[model samples]
Target: IALTDIGVGHDTLMAEVVPGIDFIIGGFDGRGIREAYEHPVTHTVMVRTYGGVSDLGRLLIHYDRDAGVITGYDWSRISLLAEQETPDPLIKEYVEKNIRSFLKRGVDNSGFEN
Candidate 1:
C-alpha cells in the first residue's frame, strides 16, 4: 500500500514490485509523482509527495466492496507556510516544544551528518 522509494530515479521499481495492485504510494527524492500509469498486466494508482518543506499530502479513497475495487480517490498536498495560521493546538504545541530539540540532535559543529 505504501513504499519509501529512495532516490529520484527508483520510481519505476515501485510498480515493478507489485504488478497489479490497485493503489501504490511512494516517496522517491521528492519528484512528486502522482498518476495512474498504465501497465502491461494491470493499471496502478500511484501517488507520491514532494519531500522536504513542500506540503502535506492528503488522500481520500472510496472503495466499492461489492465490486472489490477502489471507485474513486482524491489526493492533495497542502503547502505549509510560516505565515499560515495555526489550525491545531496540539500540533502547534508539539512543533514548538520538540522541533528545537530534534534539530539540535541532528546537528553539531560539522553540521548534519546523516
Candidate 2:
C-alpha cells in the first residue's frame, strides 16, 4: 500500500515497476476520482478521495491472514450530510471561532480580502 501525490499515470507506472504493491492511493486533481480503478496487468487497486472535508473515501479489504494477501475489497465515497451527521460541538466551536478571527483580521499584507 502506498499514498502518492505524483498522480495516477505515475502511480500506474510505479505499480508496474515495483513488486508486492497491492494498493496505490492518491491523485493530483483536487476533484478526485469517481470510482476506484484496478490495473489489469499488475492487479493493483487504486483509490482516491472525493476531495474536501464533505466527502470521504472508504475502503474495506477482505484479507486472508494465513495467505497474507487481499482476496477482495469494497470501496465507496461517503458524503457527510449536514442533516444526517452532527458536528462535534468542540470542533465546530473552534472552527467558528477561527473563522470569526480571520474575518476580523480583514485585509492582509498581500491585499487579499475575505
Candidate 3:
C-alpha cells in the first residue's frame, strides 16, 4: 500500500489485527528501514522504500520446505551513486540517450555535459 505521506502509517496496528499478509511495502517518508515483527498468529515483514531512485532494496526471504513457515530474511539497500568504477556499456549508452533528449530540450542544467 503506497503510504507516500506517513510512511507505513497504521501498519503496526494492521499487523496486529490483520492476518495472512506476508509482505508489506511502504515508503515516501524519505527514510528506508526493514523490520520484522512477530504477531500473535504469524510473522510480518515490512519494508520502507527510499526517497527517489537513489537506492534499491534487495530482500531475500528464506523458507523451510518441510515446515510451512518463514525461516528468516536477508536484506540490503544498495546505493545508485557511482563509486569509482567503469560504467556498463549498455547502461551508459541508455543513460546517454535519455540525457541527450533532456539536453536537447534544455532541461538538464545540472552542469553535466557529454
lDDT of each: 0.66, 0.80, 0.65
Candidate 3 on 1-114: residue-level lDDT in tens? 213244655665665566777766556567666443345555566766568776777777788989987778876777776774568999999988887677776764576644
lDDT score, candidate 2, position 77: 86
Clashes of each: 0, 0, 0
TM-score of 2: 0.62
Q: In the order shown, what is each candidate's alpha-carbon RMSD?
A: 8.1, 6.4, 6.7
Give the per-residue lDDT of model 1 (tens digit) for 2-108. 55566434545655665556666667576775444434555555677777867677778899999998888888766676566556888888879977886868765
Candidates sorted by TM-score, best first: 2, 1, 3
- When sorted by lDDT, best at the front, the candidate numbers are 2, 1, 3
Using lDDT as the measure, which candidate wins? 2
User: Which of the two candidates, 1 or 2, achieves a greater lDDT against the reference?
Assistant: 2
lDDT, residue 22, model 1: 68
lDDT for predicted candidate 2 compared with the true structure: 0.80
- Model 2 agreement with the true structure over 1-114: per-residue lDDT tens digits: 898888777887988888888888886765567788888888888888755565788888899999987899998987776776788899899978787666687956575875
